[model samples]
Target: MVSRILVPAARTAAAARSGLTMRSIVRGFQTSNVVRQEAATVVAPVKKPVGAFRGGLFGFLLGATASGAGMYYYVIDEYRVSNELLTEDIYALQTAVQRIEGYVRTLEEKVHSKKK
Candidate 1:
């Protein structure tokens, strides 16, 4: 009779310990799952269409400004080249006028000498 009672008490103690261990394991898993869910919620950012639109607009404006700057540089370069050409032409005309005046003076002197 004493053996029967001791065996039942021992089995009950072992079963209770196993149940407690299983409960602890289940609780740990639940806690870990909750922590993971919370971390995911905190780390993930929400996307908005307006933010995307703004970024595209900013990029387009930057491209437009760059193109405008390039056009301005091209126009300025053309103007500089034209001005240089005009200055060279003016200098050539002045040189021709001086040569013509010298030739006229020489012709007039020769004609007077022949007449005298």
Candidate 2:
């Protein structure tokens, strides 16, 4: 009873004599509390969500790019296959033309022999 009252009264008197506050004393004894700071108002910046129009545009562009690439590859493959087929046909036509020339030359030789 007397001790409780006297002890608190003595502590207050000693604190009054000292200019430092209780918060400063506690911070001095703590390792993590090195500085004194007041509470600050925090403001978080928020970004707007993507709109439907933007999403659709991006999707359209992506799809167009993918399909364009596929068509390009398909056209290239067709060109290669057609070129190979055309080269084979050209080789066949060249062989046929050689055979015809040989036959014509033989006919001319026979005509010459008959004339002589």
TM-score of each: 0.55, 0.60
In candidate 1, the residue pairs with backbone N, CA or C atoms under 3 Å apart (3 or more residues apart, or in different chains) clash, namely: none
User: What's the lDDT of the predicted structure labeled candidate 2?
Assistant: 0.78
Candidate 1 C-alpha RMSD relative to the actual structure: 10.8
Model 1 Cα displacement at 106 (Å)? 0.7
Q: After superposition, how far is residue 68 of candidate 2 from its true place, in Å?
A: 0.4
In model 1, the runs with Cα more than 4 Å from the true position are: 1-31, 43-60
Against the true structure, what is every candidate's RMSD?
A: 10.8, 10.6
* Residue-wise C-alpha lDDT for candidate 2, range 1-116, written one tens digit per residue: 44445445666567668975444333234333333332233446888989999999999999999999999999999999999999999999999999999999999999999999
As a whole number from 0 to 100, the lDDT of residue 63 in candidate 1 is 96
Error of 2 at 71 (Å): 0.2
